[model samples]
Target: MPATFLHRFVLSIGFLSLFHSAYSAAQHRSYLRLNELDFTHLPLDIIIQALISLFVIMYGVMNVAGDFKEIKASAELENKSWETFRNIPSFYTFSHRGKFLAFPHQTGNKKHN
Candidate 1:
């Protein structure tokens, strides 16, 4: 699914709604504090607005992010060539015990028996 103007618009709207609800909650708390009242819970309307906005944001994100590919190996390697799987130089190590075995006398680490 290609991301269209509508998707971006909806995402922006959702973020705006969420921020507005947060501001409203903060203002409500300040008002209660000024009146020496205990902070209980947020108003129903603010909570509802926040929940709706979350859903809207999720919907917008899902539509904007295109489809996901399959995780199967067959699907991943279907169009790949053998050259892609060839020896990668980054993984090759030149300094190892194998080199000493290939040239024992040159290494000057001979064992006396």
Candidate 2:
């Protein structure tokens, strides 16, 4: 993912190809020449394999993106649920008549109905 790593990878591939070409040239190998190869005669399985690989990569990227979306949605729902719970008053703090107490005192400190 880092630019420097990508640059190194590209350079490595280029160097490897250059070395291979030089080695093949020095060997006088006529069969290893690229100019004599047919460009339009690829096998069916090669094309199928390439297509399947592309689909798999796309599926993986989309799967990760979908997971991020689901996580964000779940976090938002949790926040909203907590907010709703906090906005509602609990029974311990509820007001009755003109006073706010959990219950009347047993020592006759409060007037009973």
Candidate 3:
């Protein structure tokens, strides 16, 4: 089953507390006995490094998603600009009698009769 945010958070806290308690309890035991048991050992430096790496990776992923969204929006705007340009008549096209006309190319194809 997929774990939700709350589930993951609870699990993380629970595991950390459990390990803390176990390590604290082990300190009162004999040094030789503590060394014999491996479960109570907790290397905090590696855990901190892993957490930082995970945060950085997640941040990078979010940045990439935002970049793709911006690119999509720009492409849509460019398409609309092209459509508008195609629908507007150019003043450079004049009639046979030298009168300037401003009619879209699509509408100019229809006969008056």
Candidate 4:
């Protein structure tokens, strides 16, 4: 579906706000608030860089959490701790104490083979 002209204009405004808002504040590395990590330093570039790095780290963590462990453990447990995301099993499996989803096809027994 195509968006209306109003929607496009709104999106443009939102993107423009980033540069405008950053430019308005002569003080660099300044944020409305600071967290434990942002202590002491108040430079705009530093703060922005830190925020970007944090976002990348968080994104990587979320991506890693999505899959890997489930498929590996499918051979040993009845229910894999790593879940199937959109039908794609995990790429790796972790070692747990008898807690996992076992694959019936590989293991004749309902429990870990």
Winner on TM-score between 1 and 4 is 1
Q: lDDT for every model?
A: 0.90, 0.50, 0.54, 0.50
Error of 4 at 90 (Å): 37
Q: 3-82, model 1: which lDDT tens digit per residue?
A: 99999999999999999999999999999999999999999999999999999999988888889788886998888888
Q: What is the number of backbone collisions in each predicted candidate, taken in the order shown?
A: 0, 0, 0, 14
1-113: candidate 4 lDDT, tens digit per residue: 34455545544554454445456443433344443244364567645744554555454444444544446654555555545444554655466655556543554546656
Ranking by TM-score: 1, 2, 3, 4
lDDT pick, better of 1 and 2: 1
C-alpha TM-score for every candidate? 0.68, 0.28, 0.27, 0.24
Which ranking of candidates, highest lDDT first? 1, 3, 2, 4
Q: Which candidate is the best by lDDT?
A: 1
Give per-residue CA lDDT, model 2, range 34-62, as digits (tens). Answer: 45754444355544544554555454444
